[model samples]
Target: MPDNKTGPFLQGITRLLTDGTLGTTDIVESMHHRIVHPPLLPSTPIQHLITGIAGITYRNIKWSTRLIGKGIDKSLYKLAPFLGEIKDTPKKVALVSILNGILGDYLEINNNPLAIQMNLKNQDRDTSIDASSQACELRNVKGRILIMVHGSCGNDFQWNQEDHNHGIALAEKFDKTALFLNYNSGCHVSSNGKDLNKLLERLIYIWPVPVEEITIISHSMGGLVTRSAYHYGRLNDNGWIKHCSKMVFLGTPHHGAPLERIGNYLDTILHVIPYTTPISKLGKIRSAGITDLRYGHVVEEDWKDRDRFELSGDQRNIVPLPDGVECFAIAGITGKTSDKPSIRKSGDKMVSLNSALGIHKDPEKSLEFKKKNTWISEETTHSELLSNKYVFNKLASWMK
Candidate 1:
């Protein structure tokens, strides 16, 4: 028999399929409309007939699938109450994390089971941030705290990939208590940031010992979330901000990811062609989190009430590093060296070197990262930065 968690996962999948089908139908219908009435380009009579039939077929299939999916979801919900509880395996956690990264905002709005809640874990168990619980569960609690935040389509457990957990390694080497954050990556960066701001405030207040210093090590999208959190925390005068002394951003797309930008461009080009416009809408089907990577939008003002899929130039608000905090950025390059312009432009296969290092053409938009504080590793993948020995040495030196 399947466990309680299985029901929600199944239901979520069903809903996703239903939405996808409906979206496809809408795209086909739009293409048919454009074929019948050409705006910029003309379509043949046969093209019109073909799109019309395809549109009708897609609509019928969409309705049929939606009805069947809803019926199955209801049955699953009924059986969920009687299902046995199951322990979360690493594979299960990873799958849910990917789902959250892709459709996290939808899951959150629908209260789906796959939407991960933000939690602090120690030795694979929730600490609950309660003073007594921390004392009992974290025997090695100390004044110094190291918080590790994972990236897009990832979870806290992923940080321990291939027996290389940076938080554990850093804790062992630096004598600081380490905490891992597991959160829904599909949500807007600002939304997660605001929640993190509150969570950190509560954590600092309930710590077992007097907190002397706090360091955040963030990877990829986690860096944006952390920056957003700090932005809100400072605005609200959160006390935890004072304790945060250092931040290390690993493969962070400080400017934005070029891949997402390319996706946006394709979306525009597809919209211009009436026949392929629906396919263009498919390109826009990526989650809000993925869209945010286009310009590293972190604050509410950056994306509120905006059509995220609209083709637009950089509109991100300038968010400089927090004052009085030592900030370090590390960018990875897959090339043998950074001397090659092409390699530098395609840093780590996901983030560009300039973006990772917070280098901007406009000086006002650039983050003031001192040369001594920034490091670049050639022939290193973005994921490898999490476990690279040289990267570890740099992190250790900064912390010390």
Candidate 2:
């Protein structure tokens, strides 16, 4: 039998090799087409020969890796019975979290073990926060619950940065139950949102005591997922929605992240150049989830039947903050003490100030957040927002 510990590693490597080989083939073929077809650039006979050879080599590698991958998969299956008993280490979980952020939808479709499943976890113990196991799972149940949602390529445990966990600290100070959500960051925001809605319903029903309030604190893409859940919960009339009292978005790209927009721009530019058009496909290789960030998509209608990486304008259906729930947004800037307008505009090096604060040129599309509800933190990067003292103080003030 294959070593259960090594099975996941081998399987993951095999999948990567297989996907890489196939991607290389596609890129080569695209290049070949562009070189030989309409709007083709002038090429010498030597260039034609080199392209031909490259295509053949790509195909050879594709077939070779696929065969090897199949063999590795077979070995993994033989050891599958024992795989269930093996617990994933923190490092493994972290790696999978990154993979999920990159190719999560593909992993799910392929039923890859690397795919992360959404679950509420007990931060004190490495266990699922199950309603049936509330007695042991939740040692202290409070009327007010605080849920922490991590960003793309993140897990619940990683919420603790710089030796401080905002969730735990806030929960302790406020006497609220703190739960962290672990989920595949690569899946569409709406998909995770719907799942979250159902999970909350179960949580509310099985709480040890009557639940009084629910407050969600989400960072980065996690914030989008929270909004999506709220939208769906309202539509389904889920009881959990009624208990939701507040939501705090830390560096959330309410309008969308600027980096994704830049990526989309590069992809469009590459496609326009015939010589480099094949390389453009690499830009499209990002998962549906990443592409969704281009417009902070929060519903199935926003992406269903559409090519996620297509060069198009913001097609996202504007999803305003849920009614009756107090919403707060935090924007972070990298500079320590810069008065330059550019420094403030370049928010957190990932999201823009306008997007994070839900400021839009169009009034109808802009989210109506009260001035007091929004914050801007200078000398803080996007990730630093997770543990910054100033941000923490603001969160505590809002919760209070």
How many clashing residue pairs appear in each of the predictions shown? 0, 0
Over 1-400, each residue of candidate 2 has an lDDT whose tens digit, in order, gives 4455556655765787677778777787777767665473577787778777877876787788788888878888677657754466667678878888988888888877677778888767466754333443466689899999998888986788889999999999999989999888888999999988888888898788899999999999999999999999999999999999999999998888878989998998998886888898888768878988998888999999997777788877888889999999999988754568877888899999888999988888899999999999988989999889999999999999
Q: Clashing residue pairs, candidate 2?
A: none
RMSD of each: 3.4, 3.2
In model 2, state the lDDT of residue 176: 94
TM-score for each model: 0.89, 0.89
Candidate 1 lDDT by residue in tens digits, 1-400: 5446767777777787777777767876776676576776778888777777886787788779888978988997998867666557888788889988888888898777678888778755655452223333466589898989889998777787667888888888988988888888898888888888888887887777899999999999999999999999999999999999999999999899988999999999988876787678777667888889998988988899889999999988889999988999999998866376976768999999999999999999999998999999878898998888888888888988
For model 1, where is the 10-residue window of minimal lDDT?
128-137
lDDT of each: 0.84, 0.85
Which portions of model 2 miss their true places by more than 4 Å?
1-10, 29-58, 80-89, 130-136, 336-338
Q: Report the error of model 2 at residue 144, Å.
A: 2.0
